[model samples]
Target chain A: MLAAARDAFAERGFEGASIRGIATAAGVDPALVHHYFGTKDQLFLAAVQAPADPEELLPEVLAGGPEELGRNLLGMFLRVWDGPARAGGLALVRSAVGSEWTAKLLREFLVARVLRRVVGTLGYSPAERDARGALVGSQLIGLVMTRYVLKLEPIASASRESLVEAYAPTLQRYLTGDVVLPG
Target chain B: MLAAARDAFAERGFEGASIRGIATAAGVDPALVHHYFGTKDQLFLAAVQAPADPEELLPEVLAGGPEELGRNLLGMFLRVWDGPARAGGLALVRSAVGSEWTAKLLREFLVARVLRRVVGTLGYSPAERDARGALVGSQLIGLVMTRYVLKLEPIASASRESLVEAYAPTLQRYLTGDVVLPG
Candidate 1:
């Protein structure tokens, strides 16, 4: 069922990959899928083995002073990518890069689960918040692609501490600094 | 020859795709490829319609004071991406994401043509230079992926000026700011 879910998500994306379709692909009843995983979202979360639970993790990272949020956030990201869950994280990125469906799934997951929660804590206008979140997303996503998936040198070889130091300030700027947005 | 080069690049990557192979695929003599394009690298530049001649453009971008370098770099990037050359840029990024071969190709191009030249202008140690180059590559590549390929919101809709304002500082930081490197 999980394999079916992954294939379905890879091929059809989140909106197109229905529970019934997944069940059919798995040669199981839709009820079986429901029994195993309460909902499609749950099923996806389970199948992707999402590297970290944003709800559980973001609070801890965001607990520090706002200025420290960027460092803390990057620290958390590095840990997740370097931890035992690295395989799952890598798979998710590879899949996301491969198909629009997976990209949308990953985007929805990041924006809804992660970015919004982080940005929502800061009292910015909706436009500002959205722009900031997207900026942060671009930085982190690029970091992971070069460091892990593409394994670009220097980044792949740099110590976690170095990355944290080098990137935290940039992330910091995205999180709280003044940015010019479309008026 | 150009189509064959594109397909070969997409399928086999920079390292694996041979001039002989591309020539065979194109049903042309290998000498013809060498005569027309000069080298595989030149062939790729031709096939992808690379945004600008890095040698010519990078000097212009890097010409000003260091503080202004980030804005100039990003401004140039946006022009290449938002201008008539956008399709080629988008195709190169898509191909890079889809295959490791292309990723390596793109990486080499960025590192050799763009990042190294920019970083080389700064008087950092080789290790520091490599690290900074990789860091800048991550941000720019990520920007293109989200903005052009994935079409992530806010970023997708963002004005070129807005993005330049939002991201140039981050790039500036990577280029010349104090980043703690691994000892």
Candidate 2:
């Protein structure tokens, strides 16, 4: 089922891949798939070995509210990557870089499972919200790649709060500042 | 020689790895290596399959002087990734993500061959300069990873100028703004 789910997600993305279709590909009943994973997002998480759970994480991460959204999001990201989620997160990143299929799955997971939910709470127009999400994604991806994968100096060794304090403003701007929207 | 260059670089990094050592590993004279590759930078470029040449690029990239540095740099980056350098750039990124050695080599190249020279022209404390470089690296890595590798929407499809206009601030801020220096 997991393999089938991965194949489905990789081939069709989150919006295109359906629970029923995934079940059919896996040779399992649709009810069993739902019973096993709860929702499409949950199943996608299982398929990709999700680094963190958005459902459980989004509220806690956002509890600091709008002003601290950037700090909280960045801090939460630092924690997730620093802990046990490190290995799985590394694996997903590694796989994504090499394979287009895996990259799409990773994209679907980030956009559908994570960024959209985080950006949804903001009262911006849909277009503004999406551009914000992409900006946020770019910074996070660069930070993670350098600190964890490349282990770039000072950045890799910097304390989490220190990084959060130093860098959170960049995120804050992207999330809530008067950023230029796409034409 | 290229394989030997890769090994030496991956193990000892750009500064640490010498032509003599690479040549020794390849069972050739140091002069022969230098004769063929010209300089250590060129050798490293061939070894890693550099997406673009810094020597050729830095002058034009930084020609806008300090005021327009961010815009010029980002514009240059978008052009490089959107052109023939795209495949080699993608290959290097993919390999780096999966291998620690490759990641180290990448860090060394970015720091020694590119960032240091770019930052050196400005008069600042070494620590301040280093921090700025790291911050710039974080954003550029993120942009390339998403725009080219992951193909994150709007970002991937965004008009080059729109992206440059939207993103140059982040880079400019990191480069010239009063960024918080590490203690």
CA shift at B105, candidate 2, in angstroms? 1.3
Model 2 residue B45 lDDT score:
92
Q: Which regions of candidate 2 fall more than 4 Å away from where they truly are? A: none
lDDT of 1: 0.81
Compute the lDDT of residue B147 as modeled in candidate 2: 88
TM-score of each: 0.79, 0.95
- Candidate 2 has a TM-score of 0.95
Q: What tens-digit string does per-residue lDDT give for candidate 2 at A12-37?
A: 88889999999999998999999999
Q: What TM-score does each prediction get for chain A alone?
A: 0.77, 0.93
- Candidate 1 has an interface RMSD (Å) of 2.1
Cα lDDT, model 1, residue B169: 82
**Clashing residue pairs in candidate 1, if any?**
A13-A101, B13-B101
Model 2 docking tier (incorrect/acceptable/medium/high): medium
* Model 1 ranges off by over 4 Å: A1-34, A39-44, A47-49, B1-34, B39-52
Chain B TM, per prediction: 0.76, 0.93
Over the stretch A1-183, how does candidate 1's per-residue lDDT look in tens digits? 999998887567656789999999999999999999988878878766687777778878888978899999999888888998787877777777666777777876777677878987889988788788888989998988888766778888778888888888888888898776532
